[model samples]
Target chain A: MNRTFGEKVFNVFNLLFFLVFSIILLIPILYILQQSVDVGAVKSGLSLWPSDPSTAYYKMVLGDQGIYGPLLNSIYITVVGTTLSVLINAAAAYPMSRRDYKPNKFLVYYIVIIPMLFSGGQIPTFLVLKELGLLNTLAVCFLPVLASGWNIVLIRNYYRSIPESLIEAAKIDGAGEFYIFGRIILPLSKPVIAAISLFTGVGLWNTFTPALMYNSDPTKYTFAVKLREMIVVQEDMSRQFEAMMQQMALSSASGQAMTNEGLSAAMMIISIIPIIIVYPFLQKHFASGLMVGSVKG
Target chain B: MERKLIGKKKGGRLGTTNIVLTLMVLPAVILLTIFHYLPLPGVAIAFAKYNIGGFQEWVGFENFQYIFKLNNFWRAFLNNWMYVALNYVFIFPSSIILAILFNEVRIRPYKKFVQTISTLPHFLSWAVVGGIWMLLLSPSNGYINQIIEALGGEPIYFFANNTTFPLLYTVIAIWKSVGYNSIIYLAALSGIGLELYEAAAIDGAGRWKQTLHITLPGLKPTILVMFVLSFASILNLFEPLYVLSNAMVRESSMVLDTYIFQSGIMQGRYDISTAMGLFKSTISLVLVLASNFLSKRLTEDGQSIL
Candidate 1:
């Protein structure tokens, strides 16, 4: 329990380094939060504190019909997409994990592993989506991402670790495969399922290119695609703010003042809020899930 | 006689269980065939003359030849490898160093606080991350530039200046990923026996000496496996580059991913673009196979990491 002078110095330095490093990491997010509230620093320079703090930016982001369409699209896509992905991955993984199943080897190697190694790349995949008439639809957001080799592999590994005797006992009791999978395996596999759903949900929520590539219609854009347009593609976010203000003037309150920086910050934070809320609860699962995926199949 | 009996029982039970399990796996197979397997054959478009409408003609190796001839293709190809090498030098070991640092922390609550804040950025999409960095690095009124001006130094245009663009991009990439990547190393580090460190300490080993002899050597196998695994998807780094790059830094930022997207999707040069994609995929597959082979040779159990 005794420490040398060098050790003591190292500890002090480490603490200060992390203290500063943590602050540096948080600055962007903190700056955004501050900008979202403070109207006074709209045009320039970092503000440590909000001068004219208001909730108007949040209201603009939340209430505007312009943002609503994309928000609904994102919510529906993430919900449905994640559910379908988790279900399909679980179903696929369960069967593939069964040692007695004849096709398990072929399914694992040929069907899953081969595709993981080689892909037709962007154009071919885009073409396939187009051929299937999935382009420009909300379904495009989730359909192509429904089954991933990595997710299946992770889930299958989890399934493989489940005691085989449990399934055997169920089979002895005249339980069908579907019943065993639905009743026993699904419940037992909650941890893996939660992990997959959390990742898939986040991926779907942050989905950009699929929405960007497939959905040309402004009405069909996901929150990510819409936000990209608002913040990145269009240099002049102030014009969008003016348009929002005009719409607000007609729809609700007319006198409220909000800046482009405030609006952009609010938009970024709103998009990230779902993740922030869910992450703390499921972080351990995410870490464990990553390790599981990294393990040899 | 026992083997025959077991085979007979298996054959008998295969009827119902196999049918239901096959049915369960059917959806995935169908979806994979449509989405993943189907695109594989679509790589053939790289060899053909194609456009938005359809395949125009069979142009054997012409597209590949054209891609090879283009200076832009070579530039992107080189830039792609440069990024990978730079990642090896800068980005790859960052998480390991961070994990080691985290292990050094004695205060549990502070450790958790720092770790949580660090990992938050990983959840954000490149689009959002890009937006945040753009604001933070903006030349006119960016906080970084403001600080530089306050220090009586000239503000450098990070994204616009080709010289600073790659460095800035690497820094941003590390910031976003270092926390998340550290999770794996941290897991590995926790598995290293505390008894070894205690023994070393009892033998009059200092903290630095213990780390060098016990900690790092314990981490070696995990490091080896991770290194090989990383090679498999080295070319899969598209999203970050796509969201971050601009016209000004095109000279530095145009890697194979952005090249393929630009030529194939944006410009509708499907044939040449598909060729570029095929080239990228082929290299990625080679890297994957090579890494798998290396991992088998390197690991104690002689197992492939991928």
Candidate 2:
């Protein structure tokens, strides 16, 4: 393709524009990273370069059981919740996806879609969970979020693309519904399943509202809740640092020299590390899954 | 035996009458009923005096009347619309412009790298994003303020100031979502026919003219659908607002969702809070319906997102 002078100039502008925009976008996380590693006492600027880079903040964060408890809870909920969410939504969606299913329209519209549009609000939902005696339990973390209307919709959308003849053939061969679902439908729907799992996983990993509302026990808190408590709420970090110092048998002078900002930045990085790790590998699936789920909607 | 016979008679279209299929759907239905449908009637708590003992006094709209009288409620209500208006003016078209720019990129690797970095924030929870931004904007030792001090200007307290808080809110909101949101438009852009651009080019159209006449026109339906769908979230400003709000910025940042949370959970005024939730839900429903109606008018086939 032949490019005109104006087009060449525009291309140069666009490339430079994106270069600057990308840097601006990245500066926050990079700054946080720098802060986490910087050992300087009187740091007050945004420099991508760390001064006296040290792993002390990470070590302190890692050593603190306060961080570990929430970390473990977040991981547990994400793994278990994503699995159950995928299974429940997939199972429910399978029936709705069948072209011959009589109640598909009614169920999709009334039972699932209506609720998506008009929610019962937070207080009512909280009250319902309370009535069920689910508050403060690990079940509260995963159970309510297991079957979202959106996930079911996405799964059903993908399932609908599978040919009916495939299921009919399996049925004619004396294969049961469960066998066909397990063998044929599920194996063929890996893309959608992976997509929903990633979506659910990210959602569960980052969930704070559930922990905040349903669990009063500090031990039951997820990483998100703990993070909020530490950073956003500015819950006494000086005491937390003091506790760390005592645990380490470090002198009070060392504790006085260190600020909790570094520790907070370290925790923030730890919280998102899983996401950053899995993000590149799963990036393609996220976009494709969104597109697949968006079809005919 | 009977089930097999029935399946054979209907040529294997068992519908949901199949026991296995019904069983598969049972857990979801049960859970949805407990979590979603059950709380629906509980919205009535907005009208009644709620108690821990499961006793309710029929206050009959007293709660709604009470919240209506509160200055805070009105402020929060106005604040919700303010965010929505700002979103329209800035946040809405940002992704579209971003997608257009992304579409113009000739190099695959640079585009991919930029996209990866830009979309990273969307995966982060509001807690983490908010924490990072707060640190970056902190009045003391924050980078932005540090830069100001270096430049011989006063270090501004971005979050504490009502004026600067909204500006901060808008920038963060855009930064967080622009790349992720642009994916939809980029997908739409890919679907546009290359033949149209080629034909326009043959007809003495420059690259700019081709984009204007062919590319944008092709993306019209998608842009319209997205615009209409955005209305569904007009009042949904809880997460970002909750994470970023400080006491100093409360008057500017108080939104309906957080107001409900503060009043109901923290203050133990569940009744009035439920009333506020009810009001929010009602308006949200209206907005969704209104948007769907608008979508029907906007789309070429008169298709509604609902």
Candidate 3:
């Protein structure tokens, strides 16, 4: 473990490099956090430091039913979608994982190759949903996410970690395949299940594209779609911001200001905070899941 | 390999395992068929003229012909290649450098902290990341512009500028993905034998010499795999640009994916959009095959970068 002078300098440089880079990465989110709480009529806007801190923006954002609707929708989609995704993919993967399953190669090739290949473009996918009458319904949110080929691959690989004799022993007994799958395979595959659930949960929580393409209704929007909509209306908000800017120019004292940029930041915070809250716990599984999934490939 | 029967249950008619397996795979079969396989037939819609309920007429390649002539399509076409080129020049190497630096950290806890912190953006949806960056890059009051103003320089509106657009695009692309992507290189690094490094150290090789000669060469296959795969994704530059683009920046930012979105959804030119989608998908497959071929050569053991 002894280091030469050059190695010592390199270590110092490496630490500084990460330190500086990590700060560069962090400042935007940190600024957004600080900006969300600053009172709208600060007279001076967009400082690194908040001039005046208050809960006014939070109250205003919280009061709007626009924010709450999508908040609930995103949660509903994520919870339901993640649950169904794990179930469908895991169930499908269970058969593929068993070498004794007659169609394992056929099923794996069909499902796994789809992930490796290009997807049928967004338009056709959209049309399929529209034709199905699933568009603008909450079911649309979960449909595309229902059985991911990637999660199936991950779970199938995880199932390989279980002893082959375990399943054979169940077969030696009177246990049915479903009985063994439910009783043995699933319970043993908790780590991989948790991993896929975390990955799927993050994906569903942040899903914006399907919501954007399929659902025209605001009520059907997820947190991601809602977040974009709030930012997209900056043009409309800009007019109000111009008025506020002029009012600040005129008044020597504090003036009433509408939530413009602050509103979007608050929404951004809302969209991200739930993920942030859950992220630390899931971090280890996320890394291991990715590694396990890719190591064979 | 999968031909073996589990037990002495030899009945071909409705065996318990076969039935259970069929029941298990039914949902995946149904879902994939409906969503994914349908696109194969639905892609035919690209050739068909539009109507309310179904096809109006068979227009052959007219939809493809139309998009080729569109001004917006050309702009996005060039932008896609430009993004691909920039990713090669900028992102591909920096990620490896990051992985190397990360590997160099002697402090375990500190290394883990940096790794975890850097990958934080990967976990969040682009909508949230895009919003944060949009504010940070705002010409009026964004922190970047604030820095420019502090230095007595003019505040540049990054997204709206063609000159700065690519630069910001590259930085944000790297910022969002480098940490997560570097893990691939780190995995490659970890896969190298410790004895090689130990022998090098014993033979009076310094850390730099050891890393340059052993570690980087160990990562060569991975780096090339990433390179070839990314090269194929040049036209695939939709996600990042889709979030950041505005009408003003569409000239610089209109990728094929967004063009498809604009045509099909916004303009109701579903035929043209489907044509574009088919076009993109075909090229993507070609690129994937080419990369797979190249990666098989590099890895020397039939590796697929999927």
Candidate 4:
């Protein structure tokens, strides 16, 4: 374990490389953070430090009750979607995990995997959704992921990891399958469940597509959908802001200068905050879960 | 495999366990059937003159012929392939290199910190990342542009530059995914036997030699598996283009998804859109089967779930 001079030099260079790489990765985020807090700061362009930092943007964006409604919608979809997907996946996975469940061999290989490989494209799915009367509902946001074939396969793989003897022991005691699953399997399967839930939750929270495709009602917009509009339709947002200001009988020109750039930057940071908050909890399960899924299924 | 009668032993031949399990599975099965399986038939709409309530006549191969006749279909197809090609050229190798560099870091805290920070962005939606990047590169206000101006260069729109856009787009994609994507490599790294390194070191093999001899060889199967799997996802390049794309770089950035959205989805030309969708889906299916075959061939324990 003695290091040569060259090895020592390489070590220094390695550390320096990581340091620079880390900072480069962080620069955009730190810049966004700076832009969010500083009033009219984004208009001036990027700076290492803000000349005048304030929570004006946050206050301005949060002031509209309309904003909180979308946040609520995002939460509703994320929570409902994650919970239902996990349940559906677990329910489907349990039978398949039981090696003797003969029907599932078909389900796992063909029904689940094949559809995942290729499907009727979005037009068909869109038509189907409309046919089912799911268009313009929050159900549109969550339905697609709720029983996704990928999740079913993933959960089935996780379920297979459970010891058969535990179920066998319960069966010998004359416990029904429901009791065994409810009491034993579900409890033992928390880690995988948590992992998939995190995946689903984050995905649902961040999705704007379902809203864009299925819903035209402004009230149905998720925070992500709203953020996308806010990000791209900069001029429209300012015009809306002006209209809102007039509607509120406030002085439009002199009250505060809310550039679309500043507003969108604030919206972006605000939208991402939830994911960042839950990420610590996500880190533990997701890493191991990812490796497990890749390694097996 | 062992049981003579699955439910016969305790719950009867067509036992309560079978019945109950079937019941438990029913809701999910029906959901998947409705959502995934139902629309599968609607893929037929690609061949038909699909009017919602209007007379629907099957046009046979007319739609396919139309797609073939269109230049945009080919353009979008080529554009998607370009992303895939660029991805393999730069993103794939760099991820491996990143994983190797990360594996070499002897310092635990700094290593963990960097990995955490790098992986953090992967959790952000493409829209959010696009927004952040848009802010970071705005001509008047972008951090990068500010630096560009500091160097006495005129402000240049990074997203608009078709020539440099692919390279920059790949970099952003890598930034979002590189750390998260390195998990398999990291896992593969940990799976390497320590004795191999010891054996190499005692044979006068330094860090570089050991990596070349032991580390890379150990990572071969995983790298191949990852390569094969990612190939199937080449057509699923909707999010980034949807989020980061603009008219400024439409020539460079437009791909199958965006093209479909513009010409098919927006225009309500469901027939052509469905045709395009079927075309893309067919390729995806082929790629999936191809990757599965490759995975099974490449690795000892490989099982192609898809």
Whole-model Cα lDDT per candidate? Answer: 0.82, 0.82, 0.79, 0.79
State which candidate, 1 or 3, has the greater lDDT. Answer: 1
lDDT of 3 by residue, A1-297 (tens): 677999899889889999898888888888888778776465344356667777777888899877888999989999999888889998999888876666777787678676457577878888888889988998897886687776787788889989888887787787888899999999998888877787778888888788887889988988898888888888457757668978888642466554567878888887788778878766776555353323110
Q: Say which prediction, candidate 2 or candidate 4, comes out ahead on TM-score.
A: 2
Better of 1 and 4 by DockQ: 4
Best by DockQ: 3
Model 4 Cα lDDT, one tens digit per residue, A154-183: 777777788877888888898988999899
Error of 4 at A143 (Å): 0.6
| Pairs in clash, predicted candidate 2 | none
- Quick one: how many clashes does candidate 4 have? 1
Residue-level lDDT of model 1, residues A1-297, one tens digit each, is: 999999999999999989998999999988888777766534345556776778888988788879989999999999999999989989998888887777777887766668778788999998888899988899998888897777888888889888987887887798888999999998998888888888888888998888887778898899987888887644455446557868878533434446565677889989989999888755778555353333111
Interface RMSD computed for candidate 1 is what?
Answer: 2.9
- Give one digit per residue, the lDDT tens place, for model 3 in B1-306: 323543325345456767888899889888888888876678888899973456799999988898899888888777777877787788877878898888888798888888888877777778888888888887767778878887899988777786777888888888887887788888788889999999999999999899999998899887877766564456666667888877777778878888888778877778888888888888778877887787777776777776
Q: Whole-model lDDT, candidate 3?
A: 0.79
* 1 versus 4: better lDDT goes to: 1
Which portions of model 4 show Cα errors greater than 4 Å? A40-47, A235-258, A289-297, B1-8, B11-13, B51-55, B295-306
lDDT of 4: 0.79
- Runs in model 1 lying further than 4 Å from the true structure: A41-47, A233-258, A287-297, B1-14
Candidate 3 segments exceeding 4 Å error:
A40-49, A243-259, A289-297, B1-14, B51-53, B224-234, B302-306
